[model samples]
Target: MGQLMGFLNIEKKNQKERDPRKRIGDWNEYREAMPEKEVREQAARCMDCGTPYCQIGTVLNKGTSGCPIHNLIPEWNDLVYRGLWREAYDRLAKTNNFPEFTSKACPAPCEGSCTAGFVSDPVSIKSIERSIIDRAFAEGWVVPKPPLRRTDKKIAVIGSGPAGMACADQLNKIGHNVTVFERSDRAGGLLMYGIPSMKIEKDVVDRRVHLLEAEGVVFKTGVDIGKDITEEEIRKDFDAVVLCTGAGKHRDVSIEGRDLEGISPAMEYLTASNRHLLYGEPLKPDFDAKGKRVIVIGGGDTGEDCVATAIRQGCKSVVQFGKHGRLPENRSESNPWPENPHVFSVDYAYEEAEELFGTDPREYYVETKKFTGDASGHVRSLLTGSFKSEAEEEKKWDADLVLIAIGFQGAEDRLFEDFGIEKDPSGRVIQADDRSYQTSSEGVFAAGDARRGATLIVWAIEEGRKAAAAVDLYLDRKLSLLQN
Candidate 1:
């Protein structure tokens, strides 16, 4: 709206990434910030459509169609275009609790659903978002503003990932005393350990954690619920409990030689790599990919991350196996727009692997038959077959290291069982009321991956906010009854 027909006139452009060859040498973020003027120009491309699908925040055909947190995309874009950066940040903060996290890690379904993208490229919404938040931080507009009033309610948030962090932030902002319990030494669950540093640096996560601490959120790291503390203690100390423990049970490949010494889960490998980079911990021999021929099983973001991490670790060779065929260059008829266009686009990891290996390391339509290990009980190679071949033609590739990155099944059942929470038939997520996020027990609720299985960070944040609201309402009702 600021610039008429801006979408047509201003061609879409994205923030530049550090060269794959150069970026692979360091664990820092690969993206370079776009100039302020160019970012504003990109914001101007937003059409401010009557029906902005980018903010709909709905699911279509099992894929997210827009921003799961329902960010005020057009309003902020117009504000940025008009040089009202502070206002833009304000609007962004209204929905997203952690723009810093999502802007960098989220897949950006909002851009896929942008109205301007119908004809031309989508507005560089993700880049604009990152710019706005980064500028906000630099300008000192972001600070800890603790609630002015205090409530008698005290809530315990289990897990320190995006959902748990968002839930705790919202509850603390509403005058509740919130204590976040993390099982790891660091507070950030997925953001700290699960994701590699090349994508999101640890300092960024620490900055937000420090701000939350300043806002009076107590974080208890290295404390495991149902182990270090009992369920009775949590119930007695806290007025309410919200479960945000993510679905992190990694699915495994039960193929031959699975128990080989060099085979590990992708999350385990990534976590070890992050710990090694952050705390100077030595990587275990099995987890270290140096001088090894690595093969990542399964094709997803996790697999791509494995490929990148292996490249950084000086792997001799790397290949990723995907059961599905390669995606089409463009969206197929079945995969329409606004449904998270499942077309082919090289990700940062793939780009880095291609740059280093002289070709993309992905092999699609490949099914692993078995792993062959050396006499020392370490994986030596893997046998794979093509899905397209009628005879199931087999091929073997040398693989000194194998990372299983298939994906997570869901939340660990034992955690929910410890709290007396019910799980659905799949036994993956906590069974809770859909609207209230409340579990079978009173004064207890569940949100994020604990309730919905593995999902995007945006959805986890949204669930956290909504679950916080429900918890607030529940606490207020209890208080009213007590006063009576």
Candidate 2:
């Protein structure tokens, strides 16, 4: 819309990254800032289709298609193309509470469904989005605006992750007194710990949290809600409670030599590394990958994170195993337009590992059969077999450290039981109405990974906003009854 045939003229250019070899030596963000001029040109490539599928956040064929938070992609792109950065930022802020987090961390499902992508490369939406927010912050357009008035009602949010933070932010903006409880020593649960600093620096998360604090949202770190304060006490102290504890129960690979000392869960490894980086804590011997041969089991974002972390820790050698075969170079028949394309591209971790190790670290179509450890009960090597072959052909790889990055099952079970909340059949998540976000226990609501299973941060933020709206309605009804 900004320029006719702009998509054809302007080549798609993404944000540049720091040299992988140099970046792996330090714990810092990899992406370099894009220049404003280039960003505007990228924005001009937006086709501004009649039916913009990029903004239509929905699931198709079990894959997310567009922006889950329903960001106004086209409007912001046009604004950016016209050099109205402040307006673009305002438009972006209307839907996405934290573009900084999502721009850096999200997979950018919106780009996948872009109309330009069907014919040519998609608009550099992610880079443009990042630029808008970064410019806004630099220009001091982002400032704390607390509610004009206060309501008597108080709400408690149980986590400080994206969902919990979004819920608390919205509730506070609506004049409710919101207090967020985080079990960690610092705020930003997974954002602070589960993810490595290279992906999203801790200060980025802290900046937003500090702004929220200035806006009158109370964050109580180092508070374990179920243990330090009882559920009964929470219900009595606050009018409503929203649980945003993410699905953190990690999935395990039960195999031979499972009790070996060097085998650790992916979260534990990532969390330990991050804590050491941020707080200057010493890493546990098993989590430290220095001068050791590392093998990452399972393939996903978490697994890639592990690979990158190991490279940074100076691992002697590294390899990743995946049960599934490699994805096609281009989209296949099953993966059509407007759906997240199931295509393969080199990710940051792969690029970094290859740069350091002189070869790609991934081994596809491989299944771990068992582990063979040393006499000292430390893992020494692992045996793997072909994942799809009729006859299991086994191969052994020496490894001093093994990381299990399979995925998470759901939220922890004990917390829900202690709160007297009903859980679904799997007992992994709180049983809550999909639309209402209210749990079986009245006055208690659940959102994010606790209600739904483990999902994208964008989805979690959306759920948090929705849950806040639902809680607001429920509180209004309660107040009305009391008045009557």
- Total backbone collisions for each predicted model: 0, 0
Q: Which stretches of candidate 2 lie over 4 Å from their true place?
A: 425-430
lDDT string for model 1 (1-484, tens) is: 7589999999899989999888999999999999999999999999899999999999999999999889999999999999999999999999999999999999999999998888889999999999999999999999999999988789999999999999999999999999999989998898999998888999999999999999999999999999999988999999999999998888998888888889999999999999999889999988999999999999999999999999999999999999899999988999988788999989998898888888999999998889888789988988889887859679999989999999887788776887888887554454576678999888889998888888899999999999999999999889889999
Candidate 2, residues 166-259: lDDT per residue as tens digits? 9999999999999999999999989999989988999999999999999999999999888999988999999999999999989998888888
The lDDT of model 1 is 0.91
Superposed Cα deviation of residue 198, candidate 1 (Å): 1.1
Q: For each candidate, what TM-score against the reference?
A: 0.98, 0.99
Report clash pairs, candidate 1. Answer: none
Model 1 scores a TM of 0.98
